[model samples]
Target: MAGVNDQRDDRALRADCGSCFGLCCVALPFSASADFAIDKDAGKPCSNLQTDFRCGIHTRLRQSGFPGCTVYDCFGAGQKVSQVTFGGTDWRQAPETASQMFAVFPVVRRLHELLRYLTEALTLHPARALHGELRRLLEETERLTGLGPDALEKLDVATHRQDVNVLLLRTSELVRAEASGTMKDGRKKDRKKDRRGADLVGARLRGADLRGADLRGAYLIAADLTGADLRLADLIGADLRDANLAGADLTGSIFLTQPQLNAAKGDLSTRVPPGLTRPAHWS
Candidate 1:
């Protein structure tokens, strides 16, 4: 029962990446591989990164064998922590600042990630009544971004994430309030789970049913969707780095990530993600 608002909110969150700093390239490490043909140490700028922090190979990342770059998302925390909080000073200028910035980056990332989810969840018609609550949380998160570096670094990110998850649980309850009634008589039998275009990074969706799902363009980085049922799902354009699909059923799933398939238990019945090769076991 996804609605137009949910779709619109999802698109808005995805397109809001311009406001972030290019922290991913600098904060993360990458080794030479089909996805990245060079070694990049954490805190060291990629060779393709320009003085202004823009990716020189952005246009040709995929064409140049850097498919990993195409699927990376920082949840808008990179720029905020880099420019607004720390005043755009990189680790090169002040190496001591790296630890603090790095620590705060992940925390702010969690906040922004929650923001993305809440914003999307608010779009559902069933959750419209809680729009005010959502708006309050969103505004609070926005205000946090404006805090000084010291204050930002001192934040209790785990507490904030827990508080936000409570609100999200309320949101989920509101959205699925009537689903139980629909489930009894097989009212939901015809309704397929459409995870298409979702951003499920580091999410824990274990043991979920996702038959005939359309997961195209989904961002599932580090997601623990272990033991989930994904039969006949579409995964084209999906990003699945570090995702856990162990013991999951991908029978007839389409466009699954290469690493997930490589690490998971699948068979000839499993459908592979696009732009990736299936493991020998799957064949």
Candidate 2:
């Protein structure tokens, strides 16, 4: 379960735009849709971005047709690169640094995400057996994030992610198995084997009994998950855009990020994992 320690660690994983160099506004691309007002190419600055790296439409992103911006987070990678990787030099001041900073931003973001998961894995009581390995990997991942731009860009992030996922999958099993416990027949039947990557987009799943479900990479966009019992579910890479989660019990849910919550629809009755904050818009 999420706790005070997790919330404390979350401070470092959150975006501090004031310390960033507007990387997300330039490093990522977006299409013209309900989320964005224009088609922006990677490395190109958004028109709404200010000289100070703040969004001009910050307070009204959704109202100004850049709703996607509201859900986007660099997981503190923007500041780490801008302030540490590039040594506090603004890309505008050092035109030559722009390309590399933009390139390294995404790489570090991926590493930080892995770090986030590793940190959480170490906190799982059921995964205590794996805590030593998790701590070592967490240290290793932290070290990798501090490497120079050239080293970072050249790093085989996918291979490292595979290695991390191997441990994470095991950690997930340990945690879920404890949550699952033994059924009357002396077997664990709480988990379903085929829920990973399920195409449940827009499916009516209100009030479903989904405890301990392996929902990795599930396309749950626009699904009606209202009042669903999602305790101990694995939600990594789940697309929750517009999914109704009002009154849903998500306590003990794994790998559900803030960006996912931002994209989903929920109410005050929604029970999130302890470390996550309820989206202000939910009010």
Candidate 3:
């Protein structure tokens, strides 16, 4: 969402909470569950949202029965929707724009998520063959993020997501085959390790060698991965909630997002990508 008429980088994709207008606290809805203690309707500000548009429980969200808040990320969409889209005019400043802003924020958030993945895809050496198309899609997605609110609300995001998913699938094939020893003598194996959309909740996978595994959309919630090797694994859309990664190796995992890691359990012995930071709770 930060690619306005210039070159963009990872910094643009990282959320700067200070530059936001508490859009996540007000624009999104939540129901009482393990993730939240109370139910909240969309378009209403959370009780913890301060007058300055900051979360009052910022430092103690997990203790306040709001662990979901800590895991959720707007991927810099909040600042872009608040500053760039509305030109620094928050929903409170101009109440008339509140509905439109709230409606458009989610749309832009999805687009920004796509942009993040596209940006990451362009960095993969194995995906160099598809860099031209990836770059084209990235630029186009960035351009879409800069569109007006009306256009954004009316955007066919699903169709665009389908296009991106197609390319990502192909990119995964190239990278995984090269790193996982699944390709031999110009012949590709059937990928016996494929676990796309698998349900492995609470399963034991300790010390498993999962290098370059296709784990897209896998349900790994509460699974054990202690001392496991997950290098070069495809983790996009994987539900890693409460998964244990103590002493696991994820040095080259592909498409592993911050939110997924934030929801998981890990220790200092766990090795992640260079660009990612270990969660404070993963002591």
Candidate 4:
């Protein structure tokens, strides 16, 4: 739960894939599974990715059982690089630039990820005092991302992540500083003590009880009934990538997906997993 001020700045982040050069799908590898139809090497395109730089199976990704692709979000790094850094040049038109673009893709991705987290942290009132520091770090990171290919290639992302992580911890402390003494509500929350191996698939749980519930290894695929309760739920290894959660209560569902949460619905009070975006319809 955010203080009064945090709720006021509840703008959600979104991935503009068009602005990106299909980096994550191309630059990263994925195992063939229900989410991905086939194996792909790092810096290789998925078969479903199109020449126009859009997912060919976008509409049917979930229907075709490639739910993972539907849930993936690049945190707006795609457009930031494609439009901002490369000036809308794609790999197909200039194949010679693929190597540099690939190298810079992950680099800009890290920076964009930092932007997502810092932007979210800035929403909390207790963390408001860190706004200046956050802004400074954000600007520095943004500036570094805009450097030339050679300069960006030589940048040490690992060291930068370590420094940024420190700021993230401070931001977490600020968000949770005020709610130190509140008791966990039981009725509208998941029981985290023991709910291991539960089969909650397609369950009608809109606004249902689930505070502090242990939902490790649970199968929650295709579940309906949005706006359900999920406060303080221990969701380690839980499969919720494609579950519908529009307006659902998820204040503290630990280890959940940003893509899962992004596809669902929630607001500022809906505590989501780190490095993820809020759903589009969240209020």
Q: What value does the lDDT take at residue 246 in candidate 4?
A: 64
TM-score of each: 0.58, 0.94, 0.93, 0.68
**Residue-by-residue lDDT tens digits, candidate 3, 53-160:** 988988988889999998998998999999998899988989999999999999999999999898888777787889899999998999999999999999999999
lDDT per residue for candidate 2 within 11-54, as digits (tens), equals 66889999998999999999999999999999999998899999
| RMSD score of candidate 4 (Å) | 6.5
Task: Tell me the lDDT of model 2 at 33.
Answer: 98
Clashing pairs in 2: none
The TM-score between candidate 1 and the true structure equals: 0.58
Q: What residue runs in model 3 are displaced by over 4 Å at the alpha carbon?
A: 1-8, 182-190
Off by over 4 Å in 1: 1-21, 32-34, 88-99, 177-283
The Cα local distance difference test for each model comes to 0.64, 0.88, 0.88, 0.65
What ranges in model 2 sit over 4 Å off? 1-8, 181-190
Q: What are the per-residue Cα lDDT tens digits for candidate 1 across 1-283?
A: 4322333433322324354445777777899996698999876778887766678887777678787676555656776787677887776678888777776777677676767666655555666777898889887877776777688778887887777767765665554343333445565643556676788888897877765556666888778867777654555456766666666666444324344454343445444433344555333
Root-mean-square deviation (CA) per prediction: 9.2, 2.3, 4.3, 6.5
Higher lDDT: candidate 1 or 3? 3
